[model samples]
Every structure is written in C-alpha cells, then in structure tokens.
Target: MMAKIKEFILLKIVIPIVDMMMGMKISYWYKKINKLNSLSRDKITEWQNRQFRDLIRFAYEHTVYYKEIIDKSGYSIDDFTSTDDICRLPVLTKEIIRQRYSDIVPDNITKIPHRKHSTGGSTGEPLRFIIDENTWGYVTAAKIHAWKTTGFHYGEPFLSFGSSSLFRVNKKNRLHDIYYKLRNAIALNGMNMEDSICRKYIEIARKKRVKYIYGYASSIYILASYVKKHNVKYKLNAVFTTSEVLTPEYRQVIEEAFDSKVMDCYGAHDGGITAFEIERGSYFVGYNTFCEVENPLEISTLYCSNLIDFAFPMLRYEVGDAVVMDNTANTHYNGQIIKKIEGRTGDIIRLKNGHTITNPGFTVVFKQFNVKAYRIKQLSESSLVVTLVVLPNFKKEEESKIIDTIKKYAGDDCEIRVEYIDQFEPLENGKRRFIMSK
Candidate 1:
C-alpha cells in the first residue's frame, strides 16, 4: 500500500530498466495502432481510395500549387475518380494558406524526407508546413486510435495537459531522462500550470499507475478545477479532450473532475483534420482524411483532403473550422459522423503561479509576426486586450514585438492593452473568439 511500492518501482523496476537500456520500441505506436484497429469497413474504404488517388497523382506530378489548383479547377486526376471529386476542387483558405505559403511548398525539395511543421496562430496566422515520414504515420496512427477510445494501454501512463507539454522528471537529456521515464509520462506546462505543480502530479497520480489524462479542454478544465476543489484522490482511465470546444458544460466539468470518461479529438493543425471520437459524441471522420462542406447542413466551412500530408498537399484544404454533420459517407470509415465542433474556445489563462493556460500557449507568440487577423481579450484577473489586424508588412518594431509577446504571458503585473484593428467584428453567433476570458 505504499501505493503498491510506487507501482512496483514504476511497473516492475523502472520499466524494464528503461526498456532494456533504451533499445526502445515502446509499443511502437501500439503496434501501428493494432494494425489500424484490424481494418474492415471495406478495408477502410479500399485504403481510402488508394490514398486518394495517390494524393491526386502526387499533386499533379510534383506540385506547382497542385498544378495551378488542378489546372484552374477544371479538375482532373480524371475528375477525382472517386470521393465524388472532392467537390470538384476549391476551398483551401487560411487566407489561401497565408496567401500562398510560397506556393503551397514542395518545389521538389526532396532529399526524400520532410518536417518543418508550424501553426499556433490557430487558424488565422502562424503556418509553416511540410511534414513527411508518411505524414507522421497517419498522424501517429490517428492519435493512437484516439487513445484507443479511453481504454488506452501499451505500457499505459500518459499525462498531457498541453501548451507546450512540459516534460520533467529532471530532464537534462540522459536519453531524454530515460525517454520520459520509460514513456510513463508526466509533462506539465499547460501554459505555466502549478498548484504546487498540480499537487505534485496529484501526489504522483496517487502513486505511479496513471493512465490517460490528455489535454487542453481549457487546460484539462484547469486540472479538473484543481482536482475537484482539493479532494484529489486520483484515478483515471480517460479524459482526452483536445485543443478546445468540448462544452456540454465542459463535459460535465471534465467528467466530474476526472473520475474519468470524456474523449474528444476534433482536428486541425493543418494536417488537414482528423476528428477522432467514435460514438456517443460522434466523430468518425477517419480513413485517414477526406471531408468537405463549404456549406452543407448549416454551420459549414470545413474542407480537407489531407490523405495524410502527401508532402504538403491539402487538396480541398480550407480547415479554418466550423463543422456539423450527423450523417453521410458511402463507405470509408462507415458513416460520416462529426456532429458539432464550433469555432475554437479552448480558452483559459490564470497564471501568477496558480497556473492554467490555453490555446497552446497564446499561439506561440504570434509566430514571429505578420497578421491579417488576431484576437485575445481577457479584461480582468489582470487585464488584457490585444486585437490586431495588421499586414502590409506591418512594422513599428512589429508593434514593440507585439507588446513584448503579450508581456510574456500577460504577467509582469499584467495590463497589456495594444489594439490596432482596421476590421474584425463577428460574434453573436457569427463566430470569431479565438481566445476569450470574460
């Protein structure tokens, strides 16, 4: 009962003494997500239409912005042979990939592997792209089959309250602290979280054996509202919310403060979109990726054709968020599900050490700089109001480097008020609250 000898020295003596001294194979993405969850649903729609016609014939044979938007949308790859011509092309926003991220990359920059990847101006600014290794093994096998729908296993013990996932257990890289202590993680930095480091990881998650507690549904509902107001006896087998918008009152307060059960994984980080959840809360948009709706069944605007990155070819791409679909899908992942995924809210700030962070740490400080839109308004608990909309190569020391990166996380006795907007006014259900805190 020494919490079962610290779960037997972290599962029988430090995980096989750090997986046989780092020969590493930590379940290798749980055996490629159990062979993609033993396929079927017509062999995942014939391997998603042969990986969407081999990324539309490798983006019209080695991109040039997908051969001038598929030769000016007269569409071909023989009119997308299947997936019903994914809306005969057109819909790749984020101001057309920030007005052409150098002609949507890929000028045969192939030494035959890729990786740059950026995004933290969450659907408005910061975008850097390029991801290979077969689109990171189908976005890490659809986030380990959406954390195997809450019953997560394979050497289980995860704790990602994101905003730059804080890694600790004294890391100074000794094989990255024995690879995050044999992959039984303990990352913290949910944008500066710390109730004495969340009660020292809730007393080492009530002794070792911790399993699944994912991130950013407003920083895991501010660590389940301080572990349900200090009655922190722990135990969890599920809680995977992602980026934001979980609301059913934050999924009944993150399922009554982590007694557990609440899996959500709606996507975007421009890897097109994933949409995990598998029933009762819907979301099955799997079979890699291929979805559309610029206006179909209301809260529209959501186009994606990311058959897993294909070295930056988000074909019908527009993932600037706004979804809603209850059905449809003539195969490939059985039926289209995805009902409700409103525009971004994963908002939360609270810092001065009491800790809580959101929107992956304030959109990575507006990633360098250049904007066509921006927002962040908290108004109290140490005021803030920083609306911006510049971009004609904005400069004035980049508005004092964007108010010194929002006064480095609205602290230093917060009072950051830097406004400059020529436009932007759409709430009252017309969406646009990239991060708000009333």
Candidate 2:
C-alpha cells in the first residue's frame, strides 16, 4: 500500500516536475553543443559501428523477430563487428517494419510515454509510428545542428511553415508550442501559403526580425516567389530547406528572393539527419547515424543504420531516395561526398493508361528545356497539367520543347498543358510535391 501511494505521487507530481527540469536542461545544453563542430568522419563511423553492434545484440536477444532471422542466417550478433559486415544483413524496408512493428521493437525497453503520429499517407500508404521523449531529443538536436550550420543562433527568431494536426494545436500542443516559441520559432502551418498567407508571413518576419527561415523547399520557394513578385524586403541569415527535393533551380530562386544562401537538409520520420549541406555546397553526414550510398549507374539509394535507436533497431534501412555522390579521393573517412536527393519513391506518377514515370525523369526533361521549378498533375485519364514558375527570360520555344518532351515521355495519347504561374502551390505540411495524381 505504501509503495503504491509513492508510485502514484511520483507519477502525478514528481515525474512532471522532473520532466520539465530535464527538458530545460537539455534545451540549454543542446543550444550550446550544436555550435561546436560535429564528430569527424572516422570518429563518427567508429561510434556508429559500436552503437550498431550494441543495438543488433540487444534486438537479437530481446526481439523474437530478429532472433529468428539471425538464427536462420547462421550468424551470431558478434559477426557484425565492422560496417562492411552490415551488407550481409537483409535490408529493412518500410513494408517489413509496418507489417511487423511490434515484433521488430525490443520488448525490454518501455515505450516512452507520448502521443503516436501517423505519416500523412502522402506516399500512397500512411504509416503509424510512436514518438516519445527520446525522439524529440534527437529531433531537437538535429534541428539545432542544421540551424547552427546556417548561422542560426539560439533564441533568434525564425519561422517554420509546416503542418500541425488540428488536435495538436489545442491545449495539448501548448507545451510544445511554448518550447518552440521560447526558441523564437513561429509555427506557420504550411496549409496557409496562399498569397494572403505568404504576405502575412513576410510581414511577420519583417516585424519579428526573424533571422532565418526553414521549411519545405517547395514551400519556401513559393514564399520566395511571392516576395520577389511583390518586391517584399526582409533580410535573412539563411534559408534551410527540407522535406522535399531541393532542385538547383529552386535553390537559385530562393536565394535570389530571400537574399540569403539556401542550404538543404535530408531526413525522415524513422531517422534523424542523414545529410546536411555545409560550406562549398558539400553535404556532410550527421553524427548519430552511419550511411552507405549504393550507387547504380543512374541512381543511388542511401542505406543507413541508426546509432541511437536501440529501442527500434534499423540495420541497413533503405531510405528510398536516390542520391549522387562525389567521386573524389580520401576527403573524409566514409567518402565525404555531396548528395543530391532525387526525391522519394512515391514521387512517381502512374497514368490511367497504365504507364508510370518518376519525378527524376520529369526533372531530366525540365533540365533539357531549362525551365524553372515545375509540378505535374494528372488531371484526367488523358490529360496532364504542368505548372511552371516562369523565370525571367523564359522563352515560348523552350515551353514548347517542354510540352513536346512531356508528350514523348508520357506518351502521344496524353494531352499535356503547360501553365506559367507566378509560383507553384505548397502542400499543407510545407512539402513541395512535384507530382500529384487526382
């Protein structure tokens, strides 16, 4: 009875107070540490290998699913001592994780108490996942690191144009909102990026003296176009673009309008920062994970192992985005190379006529025509609406060439309409989706 009473008191009072104090301490330390240079590639690799081994061992011993796989493969946890040995393990896919979520996660670790989140099914199938206290810590550290790289100081006001669930914005979201506000970051829902909303965002940034702007690359580009069209003036330290492909043309337009250098960051819901742009337009892998670039002739997929996620071990998880790596000699331990993320797997358009094409194919065609940022929407079975944010000096002949290219690539039966707009629309979550099917 006494123990039960003590447990109740701890849950009702002591734990809440402890959580708040710890959060504050972590936030303070995060701000301080993010400014320091990240671990060198060698140290980062070593640390990741150690963590990978530990996570694999833990999963093998505690998770029945992993145990079965390991036992069948005739390999003990000790076999995975080096990074190269990771290739021997079967690649983890989203389908496998979704199908066997409970079995994949170790039973030993208690779930961190928090609300669960489901991905918006933007990729065709919505995925449900748990987000706990540790998830927030890793996310916070990554964001802080990315911002610091682009000269964002802690407590400096900034703007985030991303989606927030309606329920999250209520009293329940108050604590998280307060934490963001304390960091001087405003959460402007990405759904409201129309002309009026874009104007309001500009007004807020100018008024608040927001030093940096970060959001979906497409969303930021839309706002940038609006700013350029209206001649809005607001000096910014930098613009960090994520959650969508940051094409070179998009980067150029954003830099021109915002008057700040545009940096790109790549990550996902299952993992934290995989790559971030540093000086000289080079991308450096983040510290908490080790990644391998499997380069085919035309495309590459990044296989990553999370060094921190012991609760849910992801060994050689296939992050389904294509990348281009630099072919230089010993720069960093794991081949310090730049990554050009070619968008996600779901960024493909399936025609009603039973043909499928990817965003990269369209991108290649767009490059051939030298068009500005564009989006393709399949409006009907035989029709496609291509919208382009017209660049200054864009020619009619070039537009015709783009239409012709689409006709050739998409097929002769499909009717392609090219619309020149001031800017393309951004999604509710601040993602700039290039291909949308209706």
Residue-level lDDT tens digits of model 2 in 188-253: 655324566688888888888787887767668778878888998776779987767787777988
- In model 2, pairs of residues that clash are none
For each candidate, give its TM-score against the true structure: 0.35, 0.69
| Highest lDDT model number | 1
Question: How would you encode candidate 1's per-residue C-alpha lDDT over 1-438 as one tens digit per residue?
Answer: 543455445434554454444423223433544665577656666677777887777777877777887888775567776666767777676667766877767667564355567775434456677765455545645665567556575346677666555222345347546545555656656665546667776676667667677777776776777788887756587878887688887778778877778888887757556677766667877556777776677878667777756667777776666788775643434635677877676466674534344665566556568866688777777777878887788887887777776665555666778788787877665556666776
Off by over 4 Å in 1: 1-40, 43-47, 54-118, 121-125, 128-215, 221-227, 230-240, 244-260, 277-285, 288-355, 358-361, 364-368, 371-396, 399-401, 404-409, 412-438
Off by over 4 Å in 2: 1-40, 111-115, 120-122, 165-167, 170-177, 296-298, 326-338, 345-438
lDDT for model 2 comes to 0.63
Error of 1 at 369 (Å): 3.6
The residue-level lDDT of candidate 2 at 122 comes to 23
